[model samples]
Target: MCEEATRRQVGICLLCGLPGAGKSTLGRSFSATILRQRFAVITYDKIITAEAFHLALQDELDQSREIPPSSALLKTQETSQWKQHRQYLLEYLEHLIVALLNSSELRPPEGKCDGTWYRFVDCLEEQGLISSAGSSTEKGTHSVIIPENDEVCLVLDDNFYYQSMRYEVYQLARKYSLGFCQIYLHCPVESCVLRNKGRPVSIAEDTIRLMDKKIQKPNPEKNSWEQNSLVLDSSQLIKADDHRIVKLVNQAMANPLRPLQENLEIKEKDRAITAASILHQADQSIRRCISETMRRVKGTASAHEMKVAAQELQSAKSQFLEDLRERLCEKGIQPMTACNATTIVSLFKEQTDHIVQPFLATEQSCCLEPNLDCNDRASGIS
Candidate 1:
């Protein structure tokens, strides 16, 4: 499949972090740089935002105007929104690319997307035919139909504070079998709050405080989505050497994919060994119990006594040994082995105590029931 001529190689880069973490800036720069090298670029947030804007306008018009909005009107509005959104997204993306190119982010300089292609997309967006500077698609969707052989790189920039959204993204990526890397920008809480101070739509300080108290402060461990992330400190970016950020990005991109293979193999081996050990132990315990019971029956003096002794022994085994076995299985150990090792050992210990002190007083005084004394023969004896 990788070698198929018709298959286009697509790369997705996810820029995730707290608000004002430079995700938008960095993503724009990266996309622009890649486009300049003669490659197709897509920005998910920009496209979605355009679609949202279009829908907002459509809804507004639908409410105010008496004429029912045509499918074409709706389509045009969506197209217009996406087109504008993509244009802005691409412009910002170019800014990011320029930064990366000037800095040391990409080493040995990979292939570049020529200016001709980007200029063409710009022209299409300007003409309103494409409705999106990035890619053109049918109404109600972000995907743009392209030639089968087009090589495309997509940059996804969005707020990912919610665990559910992150998981949804993960599932989407897996379903499509997309190759992508996660880039997370870290910023101080104060910095994040300060960056949003003068924005048209600003998050409240109290809300930020609540987020810190309820969301960020509680989890010390990174979630499943953050496991494969490339974390960079945005605070240090301005003061640190330019080469540091470049090196960090390069290192993340260069990480080997072989680790996943090794991890799977190790897990499989561990499971097999655990299963075998538990099964073996259970078998041994069962055999030992049978042998001991047979020996006891042979030494019993009368048929009636033998029957009672057998019943008591069976009851004890069932109560303690069987229960222990069940517990071991529940704990993920082999049921038989766990029961035999633990229950058999305990039972053996109890039996040995009885044998070692056969002459000791077998009865003791009871406190609960006046009619049921421990010395009563009806209470049963060893």
Candidate 2:
């Protein structure tokens, strides 16, 4: 999968952290202030914008600008488009990694030689976003501060919230025989929200809380990327050319990263089975909650009782997600993607009408048959 290379020091350096946790700030400072411009940055926002253009084109094919309903056809098409887009980005990033190592091979994935990928590559060349192609040892800009070599640090600036996303980048590093390191900026949810508020385009506070709940911390026991990572407290103001920032630059440059070894790899089918089993267990829990709520409320239940029962159902669903992640670890599988997890949760919700219809009917019965025995009512509801 990789050619022989003289350089393992020049490769992907992922800047991972929560939103407003100072990753973008650190990336800029490390490249411009610490290392003095011997690096190329590829931001995730531009990658998303590049792919969004193609999605915008899809509506034109139908000759209507109106947004479609959440139909199965639309979901399938969107999934396909994203899968292709991910592949294109991987190929593009891989090319940059190769160019950094001073390797001679430069071939884009077939069909991407002309489309969005081509234009993006040209833009990189024109703006010096990526290193000059083939001439790997050449100086990109007049930098008297940095060393002269084929090594140009590549900064992957993004909100890599999931371990799966980080793992994907780590796999790319291994695939091309290049050194890899991660800078995980750790800031509390409260701190990040406060900082985010100061931004011109602030994200919703609820969205930040939800991410705080879902974001997986780096675990060195499992992932190789975690071993060579830096967990920085980004809650404070970091000056330009701060010692912490300078130390990271020196680590990536002088100290060649040790080979990051993977202890396990997960397959797709097993992950699917894990997902299904999780939802099934969650369904059983919801049914139990409904049954228990009926027994407790007896023949005096109200909307409040129903609401309490619904809240129990939600708790079960959250636990099911946590349980599924642990199961993935035991079974050597990647944790479920956010899209797939949301789809499963939505499917369970679609069944909510059926699930709650019985509960509501029981509530109606409580009012209709006040004289009825509690045990008899519970049995009837069940």
The candidate scoring highest on lDDT is: 2
By TM-score, who's the top model here? 2
Q: lDDT per residue, candidate 2, 1-382, as tens digits?
A: 4544334356567888777788878766654564543676666645545334334233323332344565435645655665566668777777656545554334465556545465546545544544443443222221122233546667777777778878888888767555577778888989988988998756667556666666777888886566777788889866337776556656656555546564444445565686666556445544554465456454555778667756766765676556555654566543433334333434344434443555443433221111322333212111
TM-score of each: 0.38, 0.51
Q: Which stretches of candidate 1 lie over 4 Å from their true place?
A: 1-6, 34-151, 214-227, 236-382
lDDT of 1 by residue, 15-128 (tens): 666656666667545533423212233434434443364353334334433655575466566666654554454443443333222321211112223332344345324322
> What local distance difference test score does each model get?
0.45, 0.58
Error of 1 at 109 (Å): 38
Q: Give candidate 2's error at residue 167 in angstroms.
A: 1.0
